[model samples]
Target: MSDYSIRLYVDSDYEVTRNLFRNGIIEHHNKAFHHALQRPHIWLPALVVLTLPALNLVSVTTSILVVLTAVAAIWFYCRYMYTSYVDYALSDDMLDISKYYLQRDGFCFWVAETRGGEVVGTIAALPSSDPGGEKHLELKRLSVATKHRGKGIAKVLCRTLIDFARRRGCEAVVLSTSLAQINATKMYEKLGFRQTHSFYPPGLLGQFLDFKIIAYRYDIPAL
Candidate 1:
């Protein structure tokens, strides 16, 4: 977009980028909450609570309270899930972008900035962690500010990573997205990425709640 430009991240961009990362990930909690509500394990009990009023097994007031409680629980669970991820990320590579990405060969982080120099988006690429996988780059932390979206910022950021991977002799680029990020998943598909696999997030809570994360790979074509 004419209003924005892409450039490598710097120490001065830390606060804005950190806030962007935190807010972007946490914003999906509502979507996850609604998604969870649609699951049988989550909603069935709420459904039973709703039917209690009609079946005369519980007063209407009591049934409403039960349903409300279930909804609140689902919301809290979704909130916890997203916040936990944000916490882990903030403490990981994000905790020191320069040391983890800038200083490493075949690894870098970039930000999309407004003409006025505000950091509105971020993306990073690093060598894949899988043992013996030198030909793959892992894309991470792709986020564009809400108001600045829909102007091709995300697509350009992704293209930047792909180009970087190509230059690094990487055969493909890989990334992971949560099920809550439906729009992102669709965009990746449209960009020619294929679903490599899907898995629930780590931890007993993630497994018990059945939250899913999808992995995608984009093979670089020969120049």
Candidate 2:
């Protein structure tokens, strides 16, 4: 794989970075759905419900309704999440690009580009939201184009964040990611980030997502 250059985000990179993030999410969602179809955990529940009618435990009409309800719930939940994510991103730094991230204190955004100047990835380091968390930095919006996987673009972005945090006197760099991002989880682990916490979306959404959200942190040594 050819090396990609990493640098601070520029005004011209706004659209491409947004596209990379959006497309990365869509790609992950598609891959997750395909994986779910093959997983026994997902299929087994549906299978049990379908077999109930044959066993006379549920009437045919009720069985059909049950199966359809389950399918609909999953579909609607995925759609809700997708819409919520896009809205959240659009309403924040991702939309304004400059005000929230560029002008904000202790927040830095970066873009990775090929030698030909095609932007392929992006990442950010932002100040922690916790009131007393001055030493902590939050890693946010890390993404690379689907076709660019296995090319070390993600590693470069991650390392850039780590180095940036170290230079900024950050005690640690943390991020929250979902289980659907298996490759990202692995990459973080390889980069020496430890699993520090797990979180859920809350209420019905949490139930649907099965509490897949997790947190990872990397401790930075003082120079």
Candidate 3:
């Protein structure tokens, strides 16, 4: 917040912004891994493995092998999911920022630059899925570097997008965040965003997992 100013994204800022987003997701992933490991669901698999040996349904050696396999599978699954998300983002809007963001109507990307010319944060606003109804705007890729946290950079970035959307006659601003981002959720709430939808991937795997993505919407007042 000292000498930093938020400005529209440019071609030269693409690499820096992309890397910042990648690192931000990785930071959340690591925190989520630790939080998930502490949950009862992770322990349930081990509990079943231990109980099988005690109940004589499986031999001790077999029980140990099963536990090892389950642990390995869980580890692999988490890493795979994280990698998939990163790859998709890289190939999507982040791949060609100008095409997906800059060139689109009612879409814009912004990056926060320091007095020394370092990009420290980014945020964007894009047309909502239902553009004809309610005139919505979706805020995307809001992130600030770790070293720049607690300095009001994120708040500035968020406000910048919201104000921009308001000026364009948007009725509301919408965004989504995963459960892993506890702090971000709180910040959104503090910014007057209300929880609108809770989402999770489909299928049996999703039912068994604790993963959830929560959507929030901020109703904009007429300017």
Q: Give the number of the best model, judged by TM-score.
A: 1
Q: Kindly report which residue stretches of model 1 are placed more than 4 angstroms away from their true locations once superposed.
A: none
In candidate 3 the C-alpha lDDT for residue 56 amounts to 86
**What does candidate 1's lDDT look like per residue over 1-223, in tens digits?**
9899999999999999999999999999999888877778877877888888798889999999888887888789889999988999999999999999999899999999999988999999999997666899999999999999889999999999999999988999999988999889989999999998999976776765667899999999988
Query: How many clashes does the backbone of model 3 have?
Result: 0
Global local distance difference test of model 2: 0.81
The digit string of per-residue lDDT tens for model 3 on 65-139 reads: 887887667666655556678789999989999889989889999999999999999998898885464589998
CA lDDT, candidate 2, residue 100:
72
- The reply for model 2, stretches above 4 Å from the true place, is 30-45, 55-65
Return the lDDT, model 2, position 76: 61
lDDT of 2 by residue, 1-223 (tens): 3568998899899889888877776556544444445556667888898889889899988887987887767656665665577678867779877777789778899998888999999998898876666898999989998788899999889999989888888999989887678899999999999998887776765544453678898999767
TM-score of each: 0.94, 0.86, 0.89
User: lDDT of each prediction vs. the true structure?
Assistant: 0.91, 0.81, 0.84
List pairs with backbone clashes in candidate 2: none
RMSD to the true structure for each prediction, in A, is: 1.5, 2.8, 2.2
lDDT of 3 at 82: 61
Those runs of model 3 whose alpha carbons end farther than 4 Å from true positions after fitting are 35-42, 55-62, 130-134
Candidates ranked, most accurate by TM-score first: 1, 3, 2
